[model samples]
Target: MRVGLYPGTFDPITIGHIDIIRRATALVDRLVIGVAINRDKGPMFSLEERVAMLEAEIAPLQQETGVEIVAHPFENLLIDCAHDVGAGLIIRGLRAVADFEYEYQMVGMNRALDSSVETVFLMADLKHQAIASKLVKEIARLGGDVSKFVTPAVCDALYKRLGR
Candidate 1:
């Protein structure tokens, strides 16, 4: 089976992220949204909370496509996780040039590890091109609305965490 692995910190799993996963689902037999565990970054939501929020956001799409959203607490390496999941394609969402620079390097390293593995870059919708998890959290913390950028569950989680 051709499985596409969409991996990211998903600090909160924005709508933009969801759009990419949704589109990727149509292109692959299986889509696994891998939530990378970054200890240094210090997650806004606890790993459990983030996973729950992601599950809620992607549940509908999973129901539609037989896809699944699961959290893989990855602190070691991306290639290791990909190999563990038997992913042949790495799905990444590109919002702008900044993301390209980072993703390009990752693609090269991933390819080096497994020449058969390929990275599939998907462009974010123009509306969400600049949306990112950190920015969303910052805006929400300052009492700015980010409901348009993130899912309802994520919005609620942010507010609850911030005591808003």
Candidate 2:
């Protein structure tokens, strides 16, 4: 089976993320959404919280696409996570050229780490192209309505986390 790994912080999964996950399902037999804890950035939700939210948000989509979706929490390198999940490909979502340079370097490093794992980039849908987790959290933190960016559950979680 062609298994793909889509790893991200997913502090809160946004519609853009949903778009990528939905699109990626068509390419792989099983897609594992690896939610890694990025110690570099302070996230709004805990790892457990993020995993629960991801599972909740993806449940319906899993039924719709018929592609097995699993959320995993990883603390080590991304390549290791891919290996653990038996992923032959690493799926990444690209929003614009600005995201290219960074992701390009990441692909190179990931390749160097594991030559067996190939990287695939999927452009975000136009409607969600501008949405980002950081921006979504920022907007929500400042009391801006982010209902359109994230799901209702995530929106409520964000507000609750921010003590709004």
Candidate 3:
């Protein structure tokens, strides 16, 4: 069915994520937004909260974006998650050289786990490349507005989390 998976911790989904989803939808029949579970890195929002935020953020663009947004807690190996969901392709967005370095290693690791599944890398739209969850959180944490880069869902969650 040409299902593609786009997985990340998504501590908070950003405009970059939405942009990737927008682009990935064009190349595959369906896109599964897999939310990875990080055991070591503590997140501001709970996994459930992050998923809810993602769902709300994507609601308005659900029809217009032409991508199905589904969040899976990738507790197991990511390849297994893809296999479980019948994803033959993995879509990732690259923002810069550093991102490529990290993602390249991940791509290799994913391939080692499942050679049948291919990782497809997409360059982030220039305007959205700098919009990262960590940066967004940092900005919000410091009381800096990130309205242009984050969706309303994320903004609300950020504000709530920051007690603003």
Candidate 4:
């Protein structure tokens, strides 16, 4: 089976993420959503919460696409996480040129570490391209509506987290 790893902090899974995941399902039989446990970032949501949010958001996509979608939390290197998940492909979502600059360096480093695994970039839908998890959290924290960026469930979780 062709397995792919899509790694991210996923503090709160945004619609943009869902769009990439939905499109990525077509490329792999199983898509592992790697929820990174990067303490350096000081994410708004815990690893458990992030995993739960990813699970909740992708369940319907899995059902619709008939692709096995699983959430795997990892604190180790992303390349190592890909190997752990048996992913020969690493899927990344690109929002803009800024994202490409960072991802380009990551792809090079990951390739240097493991030549066998490949990285694929999917462009976010134009409407959702500007929707980022950090921005979503910021808007939510400032008492702004984030319904357009995230699902109702995630929006609720963000608000509950911010005590809004």
The global C-alpha lDDT for each of the candidates, from Candidate 1 onward, is: 0.85, 0.94, 0.85, 0.95
User: Which pairs clash in the backbone of model 1?
Assistant: none
Residues 1-164 of candidate 3: C-alpha lDDT, one tens digit per residue? 68999998888888899889888889887778888878677888788887887777666666887666566777788899899899999998999999999999998898888799999999999999888898999999999998988887678878988999
**Which sections of candidate 2 miss by over 4 Å?**
none
> What is the overall TM-score of model 1 with all chains considered together?
0.95
Which residue runs does candidate 1 get wrong by more than 4 Å?
none
TM-score of each: 0.95, 0.97, 0.94, 0.99
lDDT of 3 at 49: 85
Give the C-alpha miss distance for residue 75 in model 3, angstroms.
1.0
Candidates 3 and 4 compared by lDDT, better number: 4
Highest-scoring model, TM-score: 4
List the candidate 4 regions with Cα displacement exceeding 4 Å: none
What does candidate 2's lDDT look like per residue over 35-86, in tens digits?
9998788887889999999999889989999999999899888899999999
Q: Candidate 4 — what's its lDDT?
A: 0.95
Ranking by TM-score: 4, 2, 1, 3
lDDT of 1 by residue, 106-154 (tens): 9898888888888899999999998999999899889999889987778
Backbone Cα, N, C clashes tallied per candidate:
0, 0, 0, 0
